[model samples]
Target: MSKVTNLNQFRKQQARVKKREQGSVNAEKFGRSKAEKALQESRATKERRDLDGHQREHDE
Candidate 1:
């Protein structure tokens, strides 16, 4: 005897698997680690501070 499957459940399961596969592909292509993000943020902050430090103040 052959087993029958629930069509709606089977379709939902397949969609979940496809979504997971696409997520992994996108992550590998565009994702960055926590450390890399923090390092870049800190560098930007420091650059901004340095530029601000070089600006002149005017007094009346």
Candidate 2:
């Protein structure tokens, strides 16, 4: 006689693996590190400051 395994357990394990894969994909697509976000914000601030510095004051 051959050993019998629980089919429900196998299905649950398969579902868990699929969920784990989806979570990883979502994290990669939607996640950013703090340092990366900070760097982007820093660059944007610098650009804005430079643009403002170059603007001439106009009196109307």
Candidate 3:
């Protein structure tokens, strides 16, 4: 005789794994990490400050 199994639970588990894999794939395709974004912002700010520092001050 064949053993009884809960098919509904198995289907739900498989769906969860598939959704998780899809989420990871979407993240890689569409998103940057917080650290990377923060680093880029800081680099831009530093560049702006350096440019401002190099400018000659206007005299009245």
Candidate 4:
């Protein structure tokens, strides 16, 4: 004989597990530390500055 289970409780537990899984996926996708973000920002700024420095001045 199989053990009896409450259907409603089982459904809720399934939903919770799915939600937790989604949360972890999202965390991996979007999680970043402040230092990491700052480093990225600084790199971008330096790249932009370097690019701008290479532009030629034109007089009309």
Candidate 5:
């Protein structure tokens, strides 16, 4: 029989390939809705504003 030095390496490579294939399938299947997109943007904006407010308070 041939040597199998690194089974872990083979498993990792398989996992990476599988993950990429699944990601592509998911991307095609259920993309974001407009409402979800808007909600995400709003949450990001709110987080930034909160951070800025905290920085301003600390600077004073």
Candidate 6:
């Protein structure tokens, strides 16, 4: 019984390792370019500014 439990745990760990390897491969395959990274940062900054403006309006 304990052996079976240990086997199950080992299988689960193996599956998780495979999953992380696949995720890393996929991330490298579709990694962002510099332009894309800059665009994302700009959009995030705009969103934060918009949220701050809205909050200030509500406080007034």
Report, for every candidate in turn, its global Cα lDDT versus the true structure.
0.99, 0.99, 0.97, 0.99, 0.91, 0.90
Clashes of each: 0, 0, 0, 0, 0, 0
lDDT string, candidate 6, 1-60, tens digits: 344458788899999999999999999998898999999999999999999888744454
* Cα RMSD, model 4: 3.0
Ranking by TM-score: 1, 4, 2, 3, 6, 5
Model 3 Cα lDDT, one tens digit per residue, 1-60: 998989999999999999999999999998899999999999999999999999999999
* Candidate number achieving the greatest TM-score relative to the actual structure: 1
Compare candidates 1 and 5 on TM-score and give the better one.
1
lDDT of 2: 0.99
Minimal lDDT window, size 10, model 1: 51-60
Off by over 4 Å in 5: 1-30, 56-60
Write model 2 residue lDDT over 1-60, tens digit each, in one string. Answer: 999999999999999999999999999999999999999999999999999999999999
Query: Which pairs clash in model 6?
Result: none
Q: What are the clashing pairs of model 3?
A: none
Residues 1-60 of candidate 1: C-alpha lDDT, one tens digit per residue: 999999999999999999999999999999999999999999999999999999999998
TM-score, per-candidate, Cα-based: 0.83, 0.59, 0.54, 0.69, 0.45, 0.48
Give me the runs in candidate 6 sitting further than 4 Å from their true place: 1-5, 33-60
lDDT of 4 at 44: 100
